[model samples]
Target chain A: MRFSALRVFREALTGHKGWTPTWRDPDPQPSYDIIIVGGGGHGLAAAYYLAKEFRRARIAVLERGWIGGGNVGRNTTIIRSNYLLDGNQPFYEFSMKLWEGLEQDFNYNAMVSQRGILNLFHTDAQRDAYTRRGNAMILHGADAELLDREQVRAMYPFLNFDHARFPIKGGLLQRRGGTARHDAVAWGYARGADEHGVDIIQNCAVTGFRIRNGRVLGVETTRGYIGALKVGIAVAGNSSTVMAMAGLRLPIESHVLQAFVTEGLKPVIDGVMTFGAGHFYVSQSDKGGLVFGGDIDGYNSYAQRGNLPVIEDVAEGGMALMPMIGRARLLRTWGGIMDMSMDGSPFIDRTPVEGLYFNGGWCYGGFKATPASGYCFAHLIARDEPHPTAVAYRLDRFRRGAMIDEKGQGAQPNLH
Target chain B: MLIPHPILGLRDAQEFTYLGDAALIDRPDGLANPEAFHDYLYLRDNPAGIHRELWFHEQGDRSWIVVTRNTVTHEILGAVLAQDVARARGRSR
Candidate 1:
C-alpha cells in the first residue's frame, strides 16, 4: 500500500489494520524475462526501473537473505557527487539528481536528506587537489564551495584545528551532498518493484549459473532452478565468487569496510565531514548518534567482520580531526564487503557469457551510486548498450589500457 | 592485531600495509600475453581459511614481509621477510 499523510491519518483513526507487508514473499517462477542477482539497493532499484522506466515485465530479484541485510543497510548512508575525473563526475551527478527525486518517484520515505558534505583538506597539496576537484564538480553542473580554515573554524569550532601533525587548513563543501536512510532505500525500491509486478525472491542463494555454449540460460539456486533469458549479477562484495561460479574472473577484490556509531547525543555535526589527513569520515545521524567510518581493512576477504587494527586506525583519524569525539562512547560497529576494483572505480558492463551481465566493483561508493547504478545497469540489460554517463564503466577498459584510475592508485583494490 | 616480525619482535598492524595474496609476488612478466597478464593480475584464490599475504612495514623497518594468516579468524600464523622468502624460492633481486 502507498504510504502518505492521509493514509497514516486514516490508519491511525482505524486501528491501522489495513497496512500490508512492504513486499510479497512469492515463490520464484520457473522462467522470467530477466533475473537480477542480489536484492540490495542496486538490484532492487534496477528491478524497479526495469519495470517502471523500461516497461519490462517478468522480472525477478533473487536475494540470498532478507532485503537490506547487506551493504545497503550497513553503510554510513552518505551520498555525494563531488568527483574530479570525467569518467566519474557526470555519472555520480546523475545519481545525485536521482537521489533528489527518489522519494517522490517511489512514493516512499527514503529520508533523502541533502544536508551537505564537506571534505577537509589539511595540506597545501590536498587543497590544490580539492581545488581541481571542486572546479571539476562545478564544470559538471554540481555545487561546490571551497572554505578556508577560518570559515571551517566558524562552522565547526570544536574540531582540532590546531593539531600539530595534521592541522585543518580548509575544506571543499558540496551543499547537495548528504546521507539518507540506507535501509529505507532498499524497502522503497522493493515496494516499488513489487507494485509494478516484479517478483522479489528472498532466501534464494545462487549456487551456479546455468550456461550452455558460453550463454547463460538460468541459475541454480538453493531454493530451486529458476530460468531466465537474461541475468544481471549485482552482488557487491561477492562479485568475484559469484562470477567465478560462471568461470569468469573479475578485476575485483572483496574487502571488509567497517562503519561505527556512537551513543546518542544532541545534534552536533551540521554535515558530513571527511578527514583530509586520513581516511575518516563522519556525520551525525537523526537519532543523535555520530556515524563514521574510515578505510577498508586492507586485505582480500569475503567475511563481514574486520580486525582490530582498522578500528584503531579509524579511531586515530577521528581523534585527530575532532578531539571532542573522545567524550563520546562508541555504541556499535559493522562491516560491509566492498567490491574494490583494480582502478578504484566501478564496473557496469556485460560479461563474456551471452545473456549474462555484471554490475559491481563499487568499493565504498556503491551506497552513493545506488540509483544511477541500477538505472544504468537496467539500461544496459534492456537495450544492450551502456548509458551515456556510464560508458567508461566497461569491463574491457583495463584490458584496453583505458582504465578510469580515479584515485591513480594503480591496480591496488585495497587502496581504492 | 600484533604481527610478530622476524626482526622487530611484535609490531602493531597499523604500522604495516596489507596486500592480499602473496601470489602477487609471482607476477608474470611481459604484456605480450594479455591472457596470462589478465590471469596473473585479476584471478586470485580468496580462501576463507589460511592465506599467504604481503604486508609492508612502511612506518617501521620499510621491509616487505610475507605473513601466513587465516582470513576467517584474523589469526597471524607467522611472518618472514618477503626478500628472504624470494631468496628461499631461489630468486635473486
Candidate 2:
C-alpha cells in the first residue's frame, strides 16, 4: 500500500514525539472549590461540567491509575437508552443525548456509532415487558421499534430462529443507540477538562479523609494531603471502601461481571444484540472483534478472573442464539467489579457528611450511564440539589421501600 | 450413543450395548461411532468433551447432574444418575 507525501513526511518525525500528559503542574493551592476522587469517566466529566456549567475554577480530579485504565476502559463500549425503569429510562436517555454530541464537545473522535441495540425476547413475559418498555420510551421521545420474528430474522439472519428450547420471539430495538470507543471517552473528557484549566492529577490515590466536626476538610493521598472545601466520591466499584475512610457507610455491594471477545472476523453481525432471557449480549466492534458480556458472579470476591461456569453459560447462550458462530475462536476474557445496589439503580446525592457526595451503585449499566452520572453528580455538587431525574435514588431508598425495583422482582441477582 | 432407560427428546438412540455392570457402554468399540457430538452427550469418546456419569433428563424431565469426567482430557468412562448410583448395587449386574 502506498500513501501520500504527508503520511511519509509525518512518519519521519515519529522519533521526536515525546510523552506528555494533558494536565501537569499547578500552584501550591492548599484547597479546591470541589475535589473529586477517582479520575474516571464520571470524575473527569463532573470536572468538565463543573467548569463549563458552573464556572468553578478551583477543581481537581485525583486518580490512582492512568486515565481510562479503570472500568471505563474495561467495558464493552455500548451506549443505549432503552431501559425498564422510570428512574433509569430518563437518565440513560440524557446520557445518550450527551453521547451524540460528545465528539464535537471534546473535539476528539469517540466513534459514537448509532448502530442501535435490540433486546431479544424468548418468553411471552419478556416480550410483553420489553414492549411496554418500548412504548414508554417512545412516549418519552426515545426512538424504538418492536421487531417481530420476521423482522428479527430479516435483520440478523445468523440467529437460530429454528431452535425450540429458546426461540427468538421478537425484540425491542432502540435505534438511537450504539457504541463508542471507551478509551476515547475517557481521553475526550480528560482533554476537555484539562483545556478548561481543571487540574487532573494522575497516579495519586486517596488513602484517607480528614474529617472534623462532621465535615470533610481534606484527603490524605499516597503523595500528600490535598485539602478541599468539598469532596465527591466517584469511585464506582470502590465506593464502599472510600466511604469507610470518611467514617460513613454507603448502601453499596460489590459484584464482578465478565466480558468476552472473539478473534477478529469480517463484519457479519450489525448492531447490538441482547438476550434478556439468558442474560447475554453481543456486538461486533468496529475493529471486527465481537464484544459480549452477561450476569455477574453471584457471590462476592474481588477476583477479576471469571469462572468456567459463566464462560460455559455465556458460550451456550451464544451458540443457542447464533449457532453458526460456534466455530469462531474466542480471543480473551475479562471482568470488572460492579458496585451493585439493591434497587438496581444509581445513587447521586449528598452523603450524611456535610461536605461529601457519592455517585455510585450503577449496576451493570454504569459504562453507558457515565455521561448522565457525571452531569447529575455535578448538578448536585454545584447547586447543592439532586438532579430531578435521580430524586428517587437516595441513600436510604432501599430501607424506605422506595427502591427503583427495575425488572420488578425486587431483589437483584447479586446484590440481594 | 444409547441409554435404554429413555431417549428423552433431543437425539435418536443408535444402540444400547451393556457392559458387565448397570452402566450403558459407549466407547471406541464395535457399536459406538463419532456422529453424535453436537447438542451434548454423556457418552465416552466425544472429541471436544466426554461427560461421564452425567445425569440427563429422562422420562421427559430430570434434575441437576452431579458427575465427574476428565478435566484435562474430556473422557467419560462411566456415568449414572446420582440418585440411582447412590442406591446402585455392587459390580456389573
Candidate 3:
C-alpha cells in the first residue's frame, strides 16, 4: 500500500487498521534465476536494483537473521563522498546522488539528512592534506568547502578549539554530506525489492555451496537445497567464511567495530564532525542522542562484541575532541563485524568460481557506500561487467599491485 | 583481553599491536616464486574459530609473539615467541 498524508489521516480516523507489513516474509522458492546471500542493506539494495533497474525476474535474497540486524543497524549512520582517491570518489559520489533521490524513489521515510560533514584539521600539515582531499572531492563533482578556523568556530563553537596539543586549525566541509536513518535505508530497499517481486527469505542460513567442476550450481541451506543459476555473496563480515564454502579464500578479515549512543539531550551537533587528530566521529541523532564511533577493535574476530581497550580509546578521542560531552551518560553501545580488506577498499567483481560473484571488503565505509555498492553489484551481476566507477575494485588488484589503498596501508586488514 | 606473554606473565592486550595471521611470518621467496608471494600477502584462511595471530608488544618488551586465540570466544589458547617459531621453521637472520 502506498503511504501518504491522506492515507495516514484516513487510517488515523479508522483506528489505523489499514497499515500492513512493509515487506513480505516469503519462503524460499525451489530455485531462482539469481540468489543474493545476506539480506542486509547492501544485499537488499542489490536485489532492489536488480528487479527495478535491470528488470531481472526470479530474484531471491537469503538472510540468516532479520533484516537491518547487521552493521546497517549498528553504524553511526553517517554518509559522505569526500574520499580523496579517484578509485573511490566517483563511486561514492554516485552513492551520494542515489541517497539524494532514495526516499522518493523507494517511497519510504529514510531521513536522508544532508546537514553537512566537517573534518577538522589540527596542524598545518593536516590542513594541507585536507586541502588536497577537498580538491579531490570537488574534482569528483562532489561539493567541498575549506572552512577556516573562524568558520568552524562559528559553526561548532563547543568543540575543544584550544586543546593544548592538538589545536583546531580548520576543516574540510562537505555541504551535501550527513547522516541517514540507517535501519530505514535497509527497510526501504527491502520493501522496494519485495514490491518488485524479489523473495526476501529470512531465517535461512546458507550452509554450503554446490560446486561442480569449477562452477557453482546452487547452495545448501538450513531451509533446504535452493538452486540458482547465478549466486552473489554480499555477506560483509562473513565474506571469507561463505566464499570458503566455494573453495576460495578471500583477502578479507572480520573485526568488531563498536558504536555508542548517549542519553537524549537537546540538539547540539548540527552536522557530522570528525576529529582529525583522533578516530572519533560524531553526530546528533534526530531523537537528540549523540551517536558516535571510532576505530575498529584491532583483531581478527567473528564475535559481535568488542573489548574494553578500544572503548576507552574511543572515549578518550571523544574527550579530546569535545569536552562538553564528557558527562553525557552512554545510553547504549553495540558492535558489528567489519570485513577489512588487504588494501582498505572494497571488491565488487566475479570470483574465480563461475556463476558466483562477490561484493565485500567494505571495512568502515559500508553504510555510506550502500546504494552504489548495491547498484554497481547488480550491474555487474546482470551484465557480467564492472560498473565504470567500480572498475578499480577488482579482486586481482592486490596481486597486480594496483591496490586502491585510501590510507596507503598495505596488506594489513586491521589497519585498513 | 589479556595476552599471556611468554616472558611476562600476563599483559594487557592494549600494549600490543595486532598484525593478523601468523602465516605472515612464513614469507615466501619473492625471487623464487612471485605467485607464492602474492598468495602469502593476499590470501588468508580467516577462520571463525581458532586463529593463530601475530601481535607485536609495542609498549612492553618489543617482542613479536604468536597468540593462538579463539576468534569466536576471544579466549587465548596459548602464546609463544614468534622468533622461536621462526627458528623451528629453520629460518635465521
Candidate 4:
C-alpha cells in the first residue's frame, strides 16, 4: 500500500533496527563543509551555531532516528544552574543567559517558566552545606537565596512544617532556576538551523568514519557515502563508541535516569522543590501536572527504562512534601540514558584529531544547560578555540584534579 | 519531646510527649511529679543531681528514651536505656 502511516507503524513495531539506512548505488558528494552526528539537542544546536554564527554552509545533521527522538525529548525538563562545581559555574551560568534570550532568538515559545527551585535541608549539616552553596552562587553572580522556616512557610503554606518533627529548618532557593518545554527547544533549534540551509538528515545512520592517518575525512552512512571536511560528535554517552571508530576513547559512562508525572491537578506545586534528606524533587508543569523526578537508578544500564525502587522513593518524597499528591494518580513514567562524565559536567571542545570535535556529558543537568551548551559548543567548533565559558571543561582537566565536583561526590555514577 | 522513662535497657516503653525547649529546659523535678505545661517545671540540667532531658520520636521508630543532663552547663550527660525508666513508670502504675 506504501502508506506513510503504515510504514511508520511497521517500522516502530520492528524495534527500529531495520530502519537503518541503505545505500543502493549511493551517490558521492565531493565534501560537506561539516557533518554533525546525532541530531539531538546538542547536535541540532551545533548545526545552528555553525550555520548562523560561523556562516558555514553545506552542513548535515545526521540522525539515526526521528528528530527529537533521543534525550532531547526524554529528560525531566528541569532547568537550573545552581551547581557547586568549579567548571560548571561559568558554563551553566552562561546557559542561563542564553535561556533568557531564547524566545526572541529562535522565534519559538519554549514555555520557559521561571517558577524558582528550592533545595530543602533536613539537618544542620545539610543546611550549612546549602548555605555555603548559596553564598557561592551569589559570588559567582548567580541568584541563590537562603530561606528560613518562617520564609518557607510563607512561601508554600501547604508544607507539613512540623518544626519539632521534621523541622523545616530552611533551604537554598535558586531564583533563576526553573523549567522549560523540552520538545519546543528541539523544534526551535531545528527550524532555526534548517532555515539556515543546514541539511537535517533523519533516519540515516553513520556506520563508520572514514579516517586517514588518525584524522576524520568523512563518514560512511547507509544512506550514502558522504565526505566532510570536518565531523562533529555530539552524541551523549555513545560518544566513546563513535570516537572509538576514530581510534579514541573518552571518559564517558552511560547511565539511566527516570522521570514521572502525575495526572493533572489544580496547580498545587508552585515551584520546584528538592529534599536533601531524601532523593526526590517535584515541580508543576504548565499543564497543571506535578512533574517529579529522583536520583538515578544507581546502576549502569543501556536499558532506558527505570525500575521500581526509585519511583517509590520519589513518590514517598512527594507525599512527604505535599501529602495532597497522594490523591493524584501517577499518569506516566519514562527514562533516558545520560552520559555522565567524571566531574558531573560536560566536555564541549575540539578533539586531538584534526577536523574533529566532541560535545557530550552534562550528566543530569543537560536540560537546564541546553542553550549554553549549544552556544558554547558552537563557539568551540566555529572559532577553533576553547570556549570562554567551557575553558575549564577541557578533556585534560580530569587528570589535573580541577574537576567541578559540585555535590562533593566522586567521579562515579553511584557517588554522584 | 521528652519521655518520662528510660527505653533502651529499661523495663518497658514509656511514651514520649513532643514539646519545645522552652517547655522543659529549666527544671527536671516537674517531670518526676505530675504537672501541667504552665506549672513552670522543666529539665533541671543539674550536675551532681539526676537531670531530666527531652528527646524526639525522630523517624517515628518510637523508641522511648530519657535524657540526663548537667543543669549548670546545659551539657547532655547521657541518654540512658529507658527500660529502668519504663519500670519506674510501671511501678507507679
Candidate 5:
C-alpha cells in the first residue's frame, strides 16, 4: 500500500490497522530466471533495478538470514564520492546522484542527510594531498571545497585544533556528502524489489553450486535444490567462501572492522568528519548518538567480532582529534566483515564460470557504493557488459598490473 | 588475544603486526612462471576455519612467525618461527 499524509491521518483516526507487512516473506520457487545470493542492501537494490529498470521477470534474492542483517546494517552510514582515482570517482559520483533521488524513487523514508563531509588536514603535505584529492573529486563532477583552518574551526569548535603535534591546518569539504539511515535503505530496496515481483527468500542458506562441465546450473541450498538459469553472487565478506563452491578463488580477504556509538546527547556534530592523521571518522546520528569508527582489526577473520587493541587504538585516535568526546560514554560497539580486495577496489564483472556472475570485493566502501554497485551489477547481469563507469573494475586487473590501488598499497588486503 | 611465541612464551597480540596468510611465504619465481606469481600475489584460500598466518614481532624480538589460528573462533592453535619453516622447506643460502 502507498503511504501518504492522508493515509496516515486516516489510519490515525481509525485503529491504524491499515498497515501491512513492508515486504512479503515468500518461499523460494522451484527455479528462477535469475538468482542473486546474499540479500543485503546491494543484492536487494540489484533485484530492484533488475525488475524496475531492466524489466526482468522471475528474479529471486536468497538470504541466509533476514535482509539488512549484514554490512548494510553494520556500517557507519556515511556516503560520499570524494575518491582520487578515475576508476572509482565516477562510479561513486553516480551513487551519490542515486542517493539524492533514492527515497522518493523507492517511496520510503531513508533519511538521506546531505549535511556535508569534511576531511581535516593536519600538515602542509596533508593539505597538498587533500588539495589534489579535492581537485580529483571536482573533476569527476562531484562537489568539493577547500576550507581553511579557521573555517574548519568555525564549523567544529570542539575539535582539538591546538594540538601541538598534529594541529588542524585545513580540510576538504564535500557539500553533498553525508549519512543515511542504513537499515531503511535496505528495507526500502527490499520493499521496492518485492513490489516489482522479486522473491526475497530469507532463512535460506546456499550450501553449494551445481556446476557441470564449465557452467553453473543451479544451487544446493538448505531449503532444497533450486534451479536458476543465471546466478550472481553479491555476498560481501563471504565472497571467497561462496565462490569457492564454484571452484573459484578470489583476490579478497575478510577482515573485521569495528564501529562504536556513544550515549545520546544534544546535537553536536553537523556533518561527517575524518581525521587526516588517523583513521577515525565520526558523525552525530539523528537520535543524538555519536557514531564513529576507525581502522580494521588488521587480521584475516570470518568472525564478526574484534579484539581490544584496535578498540583502544580507535579511542586514542578519537581522543587525539576531539578531547571533548572523552566525556561521552560509549554505548555500544559492533564489527562488520570487509571483503578487502588486493587493489582496494570493487568488481562488477563476469567471472570465468559461464552463467555465473560476481559483484563483491567492496572493502570499506560498500556502504557508500550500494546504489551504483547494485545498478551497475544489474546492468552487467542483464546486458552482459560492464557499466561505462565500472569498466575498470575487472577481475583480471590485478594479474594485468592495472591495479586501481587507491592508497597505492600493493596486493595487501589488510593494508587496503 | 595472545600469541604463544615459540621462544618468548605467551605474548600479547599488540606486540605483533599481522601480514595475512602463511601462503605468502612461498614466493613464486616470477621469471619462471609469471602466472604462478600472479596467483600467489592476488589469490588466497581464505578459509573460515583454521588459518596459518604470518605475524611479525616488531615490538618484541623482531622475528617473523607463523601462527596457526582459527579465523572463525579466534583460537590460536600453535606458533613457529618463519626462519625454521623456511629452512625446513630447503631454502638455504
Candidate 6:
C-alpha cells in the first residue's frame, strides 16, 4: 500500500482499517542468486538497488538479529558531505544527493531533514582546515558556507561565546546536512527491498562460509545452510569476526561508541552543531530530545555498553559548548560497536577468495555513508567492478602505500 | 570499569588508553617479512572471554600497563606495568 494524502483521506472516511505490514517476514530459501549478510541499512539498501536497478532476482539478506538492531538504530543521525579528501568528498556528495530524493524514491517517510550542519572552529588553524574542507565540498557539487562569529551568533544566540578556554571563532555550514530518522531509514530500505522481491530474513545468523578451492559456495547460518552464487558481507563491527570465518583477517577493530539522548524539552537547537575543541556533536530530535555523542571508548570490545569516564568526558564537552545543556536531564544512553579501520576509511572490494565481497571499516562515518555505500556496493556486486566513486576504497590500499588517510592518523584504528 | 593498577591501586578506566591483545608486544621485524608484519599489525585474537590487552596511563603516571580483563563483562582481572611484562618476556623494544 502506497502512503499518500489521498490514501489517508480515504482511509479516514472509511473505518481506517486499511493497512499492511512494512515488510514481509520471509524464510530463507535453499539458494539464491545473491546473498547479503547483515540486514542493516547498507545490506538492505544493496538488496533494494540490486533488485530495482540491477534487475537481479533471487536475492536474500540475512541478519543475525532484527533489522535496526545494530548501529543503524544507535546513532546521532547527522548526515553531511563536508569532506576534504578527493577520495571521500565526491562519494559523500553523491550520498547527499541520494538522500535528497530518498523519501520519494522509497515511498516512505524516512524524515530526511536538510536543516543544515555547522562545524564550529576555535582557533586559526581549525578555521583554515575548515576553509579548505568547505572549498573541497563546493568543488564536488555540494553546498557549503563559512560563517563568522557574528553570523553564527545571529543564527544560534544561546551558545557559550564568552567561554575562557575555547572561544568560538567561526563555523563551516552545509545547508543540506541534517539528521534523519535512523530506524525509519532501515525500515524504508527493508520495505523497498521487499517490494522488489528481495527476501529479508531476520534472526538468521551466518555461522560460517562454505568455500571450495578459493571460490565461494554459500554460508552456514543458524537457520540452515543456504547456497548462493555470490555472497557479500556488511556486518559493520562484526566485519572482522565474520571475515575471519573465511580465513581472511581485516584491518578492523571493534570499539564501542556511546550516544546519549536527553529528556524531551522545547525546541532549542536549530540544526546539528559540533564542538571545535572537543568530540561532542549534538542536534535536537523532532521529538525535542537533545541527541548527542562523543569519542569512542578507546577500547576494543564487542559489548554494547560504555563506562562512566567517557560519559563524564562527553558531559564536560557538552557543558563547555552550551551551558544550557547542563540543566537538561539525561534520559538514556546507548552504545554501538564501530568497525574502526586502520586509516579511518571504509572498504568496498572483492576478497582474494573469488565470489566473496566485503564492505565495512566505516568508523564514525558509517551512518552518513549508508546510501552511497549500498549503491556502490550493489554496483560492485552486479558488475563485478568497483564503482568509480569508490575506487580508492580498495582493501589493498594500505599494502600499496595508497591509504586514504583522511584524518592523517596513520594506521591506528583507535586514533581513526 | 576500574582497572586496579598494580602501583596506583584502582584507577578509572578512562585514565588509561586501551590497545587490544598483549601479544602485540612481541613485534615482528617487518623488514624481515612483509606477511609477518601484516599479521603482527592487523590480525588479532578478539575472544569473548578473558584476554590480556595493553593500556597506556595517559592521564596518570604515563606508564604503559597490560591489563587482563574480560571483554564480555568489562571486568578487570589484573593490571601490570607493560615494561615489567616486556622485560619478563625477553623483549627489548
The regions of model 3 sitting more than 4 angstroms off are none
DockQ of each: 0.48, 0.02, 0.89, 0.01, 0.91, 0.57
lDDT of 5 by residue, A138-233 (tens): 999999999999999899998999899999998999999999999999999999999999999999999999988778889999999999988999
Q: Write the per-residue lDDT of candidate 1 for residues B1-93, one digit (tens) a residue.
A: 889999998999889988777987877675677778876776566665788999999999999999998776778899999999888887899
Question: For model 1, how does the per-residue alpha-carbon lDDT over A108-214 read when each residue is reduced to its tens digit?
Answer: 99999999999999899999999999999999999999999999999899999889989999999999999999999999999999999999999999999999998
lDDT of 3 by residue, A1-416 (tens): 88678899999999998899999988888999999999999999999999999965899999999988898888999999999998999999999999999999999999999999999999999999999999999989999999999999999998999999998999999999999999999999999999999999999999999988888899999999999988999999999999998988888999999999999989899899999998999999999999999999999988899999888899999999999889999999888999999989999999888999999999989999999999999999999999999999999998777999889888988887
Candidate 5's docking class is high
Q: Which candidate's DockQ is highest? A: 5
Sort by TM-score, best first: 5, 3, 6, 1, 2, 4
lDDT string for model 4 (A1-416, tens) is 12146677887998865553221121335568888898888888878877888765688888888777889899878888787755777777888878888877877678887889999887888888988888777777889989998888888888767744465688899877888899988887887787777778888888888878867789988787889888888888466556777766565555668899888888767888986767788888878888888877654444677667678878877777767778899999988877766667678877878888888876777778778777777787777887777898777566565766776665554446
List the candidate 4 regions with Cα displacement exceeding 4 Å: A1-30, A163-165, B1-93
| Model 2 lDDT, full chain set | 0.73
The model with the greater TM-score, 1 or 5, is 5
lDDT for each residue of candidate 2 in A1-416, tens digit (9 for 90 to 100): 12236655766688634425555655325778889998888888988888777765689998887777778988998999887677778888889999988877777778899999998888889889888999989877789999998999999988887678788999999988999999888888888888787888888899999889888898999878989888999988777678878776554556668999999989987899987668789999888889888777543334555556678888888888888778899999998777766567788988888889999887778888888888888889998898877787688665455778776644432633
Model 5 steric clash pairs: none
**In model 3, what are the clashing residue pairs, if there are any?**
none
User: Model 6 misses residue A131 by how many Å?
Assistant: 0.6
**How far off is residue A3 in model 3, in Å?**
1.5
Better of 5 and 6 by TM-score: 5
Candidate 5 regions exceeding 4 Å error are none
lDDT of model 4 at position A302: 46
Query: How many steric overlaps does candidate 6 have?
Result: 0
For residues A290-393, what per-residue lDDT tens digits would candidate 6 score against the true structure?
99999998888788898878899999999999999999999999999899888888999999999999999999789889999999999999999988889899
Q: Give fnat, all candidates.
A: 0.38, 0.00, 0.90, 0.00, 0.92, 0.42
Write the number of the candidate with greater lDDT, choosing between 1 and 2.
1
